[model samples]
Target: MPPRTIKAAIQDALEDLPEKKLDKFRSALLDRREEPRVKMNSVEGKDYITIAQVLVSTFTEPRALRITLELLREIGCSEEAERLGELPHEPKRISVISISQSIFAHGPSAGASAGRYMSGDKHFVDKHRTALIQRVSTVPSLLDELLGRGVIKQEGYNTIMRTNQEKMKELYAGPLNACGPDEKDTFYHILNQLEPYLILELKSTK
Candidate 1:
């Protein structure tokens, strides 16, 4: 496997702790009533890595790490959160902010969870890759639109049609990772139309 990125390194630290502490970490993450509220949940009995992956998917690396640190400190793991916080930087990428995205800005829990750390930057398709993979179906209609918009060609459309996992792989490898901002924006728009509730749910979580 490739070397773990800093974000993974920070999250994976939960693996070294006792199951009890990991439970607290997971609880802290799920308390939608709290600060740094991220809209996410891990199935009961999921492993630490699974919980960590869930966290990563719910926020950008910087925000994810920040929330992780605060939760760790809350659960009396300040030293660990501190150490993880020292990791240098996230690989820089250009962020495309558009006015059309404002549609998903308002969340259901805006009254309880609206805080400084609430995610505004995590709406785009690229930022929430794992969440989409986990929640969205094959979405052949979405694939059709992607093809119609030239975001994916015949071959990519066929490959991605196999399963959500395959679709996410193809999209990340071929489009979200390889294409420019315009294509990515198109993908996000298509996703919002197809999975409006899920998209809104995720956008509000951060």
Candidate 2:
């Protein structure tokens, strides 16, 4: 019998994943393929590496390794991809605290500092309500950047924005009726959910 191709092997491995996760992998893989290739000698290549490293860190080790292999294959690095596939598959245990620590370790310039601020030692929204509102207002721009970079599909982008709009409407019933603490808290919770997407957008932009 002939050995399976790299794609076939990947598909076989993905069969164990839930439909939702499988869909995400498929979409990300397709999007990566559609992106223009960055030459290794170009300045863009360094930026791409930085973005890719940050993006992959968001996933479990197994998923990250699989995606890295897929990306290598997409970029015509079949030999490296094959070698990566042969490595031991050990999933790293990640937590919100650990992720926040990693971001903070990079210092303020990493742009990931915002994430640490939001998740770290204190709740920025609770402590600085006015500033939080200002940051929330920038969600639209972040969504635009995410869509432009193909980090999110049009459908996903529309869904997330629409949901955010609905949340905002509820949080801001009227100019006279200011959002109560509870409402503001709920909005902050939604922002936390969207933080990973925002982080990916930031990494790509840098």
lDDT of each: 0.60, 0.40
Model 2 stretches with alpha carbons more than 4 Å out: 1-47, 50-177, 196-206
Best model per lDDT: 1
Model number with the top TM-score: 1
Q: Report per-prediction Cα RMSD to one decimal.
A: 16.7, 14.9
* Tens-digit lDDT string for candidate 1 (1-206): 56567557765678776889887887777874534455544535778777677767766555566566657876998678656655544232222223123322443222123312223464267677777775564266677776766667886444625566677776677655776554555566666655544666677765
**Candidate 1 lDDT score at position 137:** 46
TM-score of 1: 0.40
How close to the true structure is residue 149 of candidate 1, measured as C-alpha lDDT? Answer: 60
User: Which digits, one per residue and each the tens of the lDDT, describe model 2 over residues 1-206?
Assistant: 66554344444444444455444444444455223432333322233334344334444334445455545554555565555466344222234333333334553343343433443443444444333343343356434533443333454323343544443343333320343323233333344443433323332331
Give residue 162's lDDT in candidate 2 (0 to 100). 50
